[model samples]
Target: MRRRRLPATALAVLALVTAGGCASSPPPPPPQTRAGHPERGAQLIAQYGCGSCHTIPGIDRADGLVGPPLTRFGARSYIAGKLPNSDDNLRRWISDPQAVVPGNAMPNLGIDQIDAQDIAAYLYTLD
Candidate 1:
């Protein structure tokens, strides 16, 4: 019996097809907001350098991974491992993370009331 060899172009096409099948799907789009506040919240997270300690979605430069990832915060039952994950509680955590979780490395970024509220809104939509 004699072995038959495939042409170079045929082998390349087969390789490309196989590789494309193995590629992972793209990530889902970020949650939408009525008032478009998540954009502002994302800005605030960058401005305050929250990525230095925690991971946030939609912000590519935030590679810290030191703290918990905020990908699906809306599904989380608790915030800071204690307080319930509610709008008010999230605001508190963002404004003063240490207050919610004492001895935690996260610092108070001095976020004002409105920014805290916007951040909370954004975090809640991570689900």
Candidate 2:
């Protein structure tokens, strides 16, 4: 029989993980971004039913477990942990997830560039 003592930092991280669950408490309504309209993007997210899969902050009824929660999307350096999180890359991913990663869970949703830009803008506000 053996028991290993977890480091304090590791225990703290574990506590945060267990406590936070998926996302932080709902954030204030999203603000605007330089690339596109965040408000419109929020609307588009609702219209597209993106909340059906992801736990997006500030989006009502966005409590889903099928996909990763976008708690601090703007702070993330990568999109889907692959593509760099640049505006162009984000827009590309939003437009067609399969094209970028080939087997990602996020579907294309037939979103155009304009809408993709707005969605990206809104996502960036999650930080």
Candidate 3:
């Protein structure tokens, strides 16, 4: 018996139609909170020089390798691989990393509660 194969272009078209454009979709907006401001948080992240360590998305010149890349921070399950990624926990971790895990790479930036909230807000928008 003889066999025949479909052309590559035809296969590509079939795949695209069957998979619904490969499931590509714009992610939903990050949940909002009254106390935090994402815009302000972006400024704070730059002012605090967080980009020197972590490669944060959206922020300019946020290319760093010391800390983890914050490309999809909103989808993260845990902060510092320890505490839950809730707003409160994230705020605490941002404010004082040493206090959270005792000797973690993220340093104690002396960020106040409000600033931490804002930073968390900005991070959550990355997703």
Q: Return the clash pairs for model 2, or none.
A: none
Model 1 CA deviation exceeding 4 Å by range? 1-36
Error of 2 at 61 (Å): 0.6
Prediction 2 global C-alpha lDDT: 0.86
How far off is residue 52 in model 1, in Å?
1.8
Better of 1 and 2 by TM-score: 2
| TM-score of each predicted structure versus truth | 0.67, 0.73, 0.73
In order, the Cα lDDT scores of the candidates are: 0.74, 0.86, 0.85
RMSD of each: 10.5, 8.7, 7.1
Best-fitting candidate, measured by lDDT? 2
Native-to-model Cα distance after best TM-score fit, residue 80 in candidate 2, in Å: 0.7
Q: Mind giving the per-residue lDDT tens digits that candidate 1 earns over 66-119?
A: 888888877776777677666667788888888777889778879987898877
Q: For residues 1-127, write the lDDT of model 2, one tens digit per residue.
A: 8999999999999998778654345333333435999999999999999999999999999877998999999877677867667888889999999998898788879999999999988999888
Clashes of each: 0, 0, 0
Candidate 2 TM-score versus the reference: 0.73
Clashing pairs in 1: none
Show where candidate 2 strays beyond 4 Å.
1-33
